[model samples]
Every structure is written in C-alpha cells, then in structure tokens.
Target: MSENRQIAQEIIEAVGGKDNIVSAAHCATRLRMMVKDKEKIDLQKVENIDKVKGAFFNSGQFQIILGTGTVNRIYDEVRQLGVTGTTKAEHAKEAAKSGNAFQRAVRSFGDVFVPIIPVLVATGLFMGLRGLVMQEKILASFGLTPDHISENFILFTQVLTDTAFIFLPALIAWSTFRVFGGTSVIGLVLGLMLVSPALPNAWAVAGGDAQPIMFLGFIPVLGYQGSVLPAFIAGVIGAKLEQKIRKRVPETLDLILTPFLTLLVMIILALFVIGPVFHTVEELILAGTVAVLELPFGLSGLFIGFVHQIIVITGVHHIFNLLEIQLLEKFGSNPFNAIITCAIAAQGGAALAVGLKTKSKKLKALALPSSLSAFLGITEPAIFGVNLRYVKPFIMGLIGGAAGGFAASIFGLKATGMAITVIPGTLLYLNGQILLYLFVNLIAIGVAFALTWTFGYTENLKQQIENDSKAA
Candidate 1:
C-alpha cells in the first residue's frame, strides 16, 4: 500500500474504526474529524502512527497534525476508506455547536475577520517597505534624498499603504454581513456610506481640520474611515434588517424594495445612531488597550505574553483580532504583534530543545517540524504536538515569552502588521525596528531553549515514547 493509504488505514483503526468517525476534513496542517465516541479511540496509538506528528481534541474536534502537503494526501486516502468527507466550513459549523455562547460569539468574530487578515497583512508589508525606502540613511546610500522622490511615487505608495485602512469599515461590514447572512453587496454599500465623501472625514475631524455635521443641531456625524465597532455593529444590524425586510416584502418587489429599504433604513440608523454611539465605544476600547500596554515596567506585556498561549489552548484567541484591528486603526502600528510574536517564538524554542534532547526518534521527528511551523507563525502543531504534550517545556516557553515581552515593552517595539509572526514576522519590523525585533525573538527562543534543555526533558519521557512506539 502507498504510505498515505497505509497511514490512513491505521488512523481509521486507531480512532475506533470507520464506525466512530462521523465526518472528516482537513486544514493546512491537520486532519480534523468529528467522531461518534471519543472514549473508544486509542489516543496513544494514533500518536505513535508514523508520519502523524500529533493528535489532540480541540473545540470538539479531533485534530491530527500530518504536516502540510501530507495532510491533503492522507485526507484523500481517509475518504477512500469509506469515511465521510466534509468541507472545512461544514466541519467548523459542527464544531461550533459544541461551544458555549461566549465561545460561539468569539468564533463568529473569527469568522468575520479571518477573511480580512490577508489584506491587512499586505498593507502592513507595504507600510514597512515604504518606511524602508523613505529612510534618509538608506536613501542617501542610493543617492536619493526625500525631496528627490517624485510626488506621484509618494501618492502611489500612499494608495498601497492607506487604501485598506481607509475602507476598513467596508471590508469589515462586507465580511460581517456575509457571516450574519445578509446581502453582502448591500453591506458594502452601507459601509461605503459610513465613509461617504459628503460627510466630514473622521481623521480630519480628530485633527481639528474639519467639523462633524450636526443633525438636529445636536447629534454629530462624520465619516467612519479607520473605524471598527461602528462598521461591525452596522453590518450586524443591517444584515438582520435585510433578512427581516426580505421576508416581509412582496415576492414581486422583493429584489428592489428589500435592498432599497434595507439600505435606506441602515444608512439613517448607521449615521445617526450606530456611528455616533459605537465610535465612542471603540475609542474607549482603544484608550483602554493603550493604557494596559503602557503599564509600568512592562508588567502588562509580561502578564499578557505569559498567559497568551494558555488562552490559545482554550481556542478564544481570535478575540485579539478586534483589539489588533483597533490598534492598527488608531495608532498605525501594532505593539501587540511584537509582544505576541515573542510568545509564539518561545513555543518553537521549547519544542526545538525537546526535539534535540529526546532520544526517541518518533518524538524528534514530530518536534522538529512542529517547531519549524511555530517559527513560521503557526503554533498549533508545536503547542499541541510538542511543547504542551511535555508540560515542563510549555511552562518554560511561557517564561521565555514573558521575558521577551518585557524586553519588547522596554524597547517600545511595534510591528507594521498582524496575523504573521516569528520568522515570517520579520517582514513587519523592516522599518528600522528589525534589530530590536530580532533581539526580542532571540531572548524568547534562547531562554526557552536553555530552560527546556536544562529541566524539561527527562529519561522517563523518552522511555515512555519508545514503549508507545513499540506498542504501535
């Protein structure tokens, strides 16, 4: 049998045969499944399977790390073995059913923002590149002064760096509408109206360059460029309103009247109510986040970095998406990314130490790749497959993360981006902060490596793995 086919067969038996698997799916690096009986599965046997990096139950799904390309192949083989296959979306819906209301709400936030992350990451990279090129020292090396740069070039660069944020509400609204089952085009239009040119620009109003339009000589109104809460709230409300209108409108006029009434009512409410109200709430949230991050002697960073991964284990880390977005909208840079990258790097470092120290070939095989994945900014494999499996290493990683976070606050390190971290994260720091970013990561990795090497690994763990390997 082919290697993937053989692995697939073993996985089926390990998970209590085909009868136990209700549905199966695959993400980039893991095979996800909903099983009928978790108690019937042989967890150790599944972990011992060759080429299976690790397996864990998370968010009501059994996830097996089989690496990137290998997972696709193995999933196909699993499908051929008579197990039902589902799309990742369908699998996520199933998983969502198991979480509490808060967890489901957090997951909904993730659903809304996940599609928007790539553009933000790209915009950040553009900002970093623009910063790099605009540097006087670098420009001097290239025999070009800031004054020598063309106005047209600057405008073009601004288009790249600023457009995503300028229309951030539209993206958020569009995504939120999609998530909440609304007409996405209507959401986009409503979002655009929030930042319509007829209204005073929000940044201009903040800068005292323009005044907000007063409705009834009382309510202040302005464009919501670079806003979050207002757009999100508007999207949710607009979606629900559209759904209700669709049901009430006659079938003959449904297409025209539903959209017309939805947009008309939404625009009025969004500008007059949601925008004026939620914008203030969002500003308060931003102020509060800044206060926490600016705490004395890096205390907040230390606390956050230490506990961040622990939160990841509970699967609620997506809540940070909103905070990160708020920071980016207000500050134009993300300090949170710099602090969190340290936490992510520490996990990789701890996993690396475990991989090197362990005599068990099976563990070494799992740990090394998992650590690499962590360094590349995806920590699930390292956290679930390696560090967390060995409790000591995970703790050491937390300490390392705290130390790095402390350094980050002391140095005032910030990134141009979010969603990417560790090695690939270096791109976000290219605007003259690269050296400090590297140092912070080194502190995280070095401390974790040293601590794990000294105290985390044990002969008993190696012996246990070897026995598990033999049993499999």
Candidate 2:
C-alpha cells in the first residue's frame, strides 16, 4: 500500500475505526476529524504514527498534523476507508459546538479578523516600500530631494499605503456581518456610512483641524475612519436587526423592507449611539494597552513575551488582532508585533535546538521542518509537535522570548504591520528599522537555541521516544 494509504489505515484504527469518525476534513497542514466517541480513540497511538507530527483534540475536533501536501492525500485515503468527507467550514461549525461561551466568542473574533489580515499585511509592505524609496539619502543618490518627488507620485503611493486603513471599518464590518449570519453587503454599506465624506474626518477632528457635528447638542459625531470597535458593534447590531426584520416582514416586502429598515435603524444607531459610545471604549482600550506596553524597564514586554506562547497553546491568540489593529490605527506602528515576533521566533529556535540534539531520525525530521515553519510565522507545528512535547524546551523558549522582548522595548522597535512575522516580518521593518528588527529576532532565536541546547534536551527523552516507536 502507498504510505498515505497505510498511514490513513493506521489512523482509522487508532481513532477507533471508521465507526467512530462522524466526519473528516483537511486544512492546510492538518487533518480534522469530528469523531463520535473521544474515549474510543488511542491518542498516543495516533501521535506515534509515522509522518504524523502530532495530534491534539482542540475545539471539538481531533486534529492531526500531517504537514502540507501530505494531509490532503491522507484525507483522501481516509475518505476512501469509509469516513465521511466534510468541508472545512462544516468541520469548524461542528468544532465550534464543543467550546465554552468564552472560547466560542474568541473563535468568532478570529473568524472575523483572519480574512482581513492579508490586506493589512500588503498595505504595510507598501508603506515600507514607500518609506524606503523616499529616504533623503536614497533620493540624493538618484539626484532628487523630497521636493523633487512629484506630487502625483506621492499621491499614488499614499493610495497604496493608506487605503486599507482608511477603509478599515468597511472591511471589519463586512467580515463581522458575515460571521454573524447577516447580509454582508448591508454591513459594508453601514461601515461606509460610518466613514462617509459628508461627516468631518476622524483624524482631522482629533487633530483640531475640524470639529465634530453635535447631535442632541451634546454628542459629538464624525467619520469613523480608521476605527475598529464602533464598526464591529455596528455590524453585529445591523446583522441581528436584519435577521429580525427578515423574519417578521411579509415575503413580498421582505426583500425591500428588510434591508431598508436594517440600514435606516443601523445608520441612526451607529452614528448617534454606537459610534460615540464604542469610540470612547476603543480609546480607553488603546490607552490601557499603551500603558501596559510602556511599563517601566520593559517589564511589560518581559511578562507578555514569557506568557504569549502559553496563550497560543490555548488557541485564543487571535485576541491580539484587536489590540494590534488599535495600535496600528492610533500610532501607525505596532510595537505589539515586535514583542510577539520575539515569542514566535523563540519557538523555532528551541525547536531547532531539539532537532540538532536528538538522535532519532524521526524526531530530526519533524523538528527541522516544524522549526522552519515557526521561523516563517506559523508555530503551531513547532509548538505542538516539538516544544510542548518536551516541557523543558518550551520553558527555555519562553525565557528566550522574554530576553528578546526586553531588547525590543529598550530599542523601541515597532512594526508597520500585523499578521506576518519572523522571516516575512522583515517586510514590516523595511522602512528603516530592519537592523533593529533583525537584532531582536536574532536575540530571541539565539537565546532559545542556547538554552534548549544546554539544558532542555537529554538522552532520556530520546530513549523514551525510541522505546515508544519500538512498541508501536
């Protein structure tokens, strides 16, 4: 039998045979299975399967890390073995049913924000490129100065770098509405209304260049350009309102009246109530975050870096999306990104150490690839497959993260983007902070590697793994 088929057959038996699997699916790097009985599955046996990096029960699904190309093939083989095939969305819905209320809420936030990250990353890269080409030294080498740069050229660059942030509310609202089961187009329209040109610009109002329009002679109103919370709240309210309207309206009028009422009610509520209220809430949140990051002597960085990966293991790391967005909106730079990158890089470093030190070829195969994955900004494989398996390496990585975070704070390093980190993260620092960014990541990797090499790995762990393999 082919290796994938053989692996699939073993996985079926390990998870209590085809009878126990209700549905099966594959994501980019893992096979997700919604099983009928968790107790019947042999978790250790599943993890021990050759070419399976790791296996974990998360969010109601048994997810097996089988790497990229391998997972889809394995999934196909699993289906051929009598397991039912399901889409990732269907699997996610099933998985979502397993988590508590808080976990579900966090997962919803993740679903909303993930689709928006790519555009922001692109915009950040554009900003970095613009900064690079606009440097006075570089401009001088080209026999040009800031004044010699054409106004039209500058305008084009601004369009590239600034458009995503300026329309951030529209993107957030659209995604939020979709996640909430509302009409996404309506949500997009509502978000656009929040930043309509008719209203005074948010930035201009903040900077005293313009004043907010007063409603009820007390409440100040302006365009919510570059805002996060207000748009999110508006999307939720609009979606819920639309659903309610759709249910009550007659079939003939439902199409017209549902959207009309949803928009009419949402627009007033958003501008008059939600906008003013949540805008304040967002500012307070931003203030608190800044305060924490600015804590004396890099204590905040040390604390955050040390615990960040631990948080990732819980699967709620998506919560940082809100904070990162707020920071980018307020400061146009994300120190949170710099701090978190250290934590991420440290995971890879620790994994690299384990890969280098282990005697077993199987471990060497898993650790090296997982470590490379972490360096490129995806750490799940490294964290779950390697570092967490050996507790000491994970702790060593945390220490390394703290060291790098401390360095980041001291240097005041910040990124021009969110989402992308570690190696691809270099793009964010291209605006002139590249050297400092490299130093921070290097420190994180170096410290984690050194600590894990010196103290984390041991012959006992290798012997234990080899024994397990032999038993299997």
- lDDT for each residue of candidate 1 in 143-212, tens digit (9 for 90 to 100): 9999999999999999998899999999999998998889899999999998889999999999999999
* Candidate 2 C-alpha error for residue 76, in Å: 1.5
Q: Ten residues in a row with the worst lDDT in model 1?
A: 461-470
Model 2, backbone clash pairs (residues 3+ apart or across chains), number: 0
User: Model 2: which residue pairs collide?
Assistant: none
Each prediction's RMSD over C-alphas, in Å, is: 1.5, 1.3
| Candidate 2 Cα deviation (angstroms), residue 23 | 1.2
Q: lDDT tens string, model 2, 27-62? A: 999999998999999988997888898888888899
Model 1 gets an lDDT of 0.90
Clash pairs detected, candidate 1: none
lDDT of 1 at 200: 97
TM-score of 1: 0.96
Give the number of the best model, judged by TM-score: 2
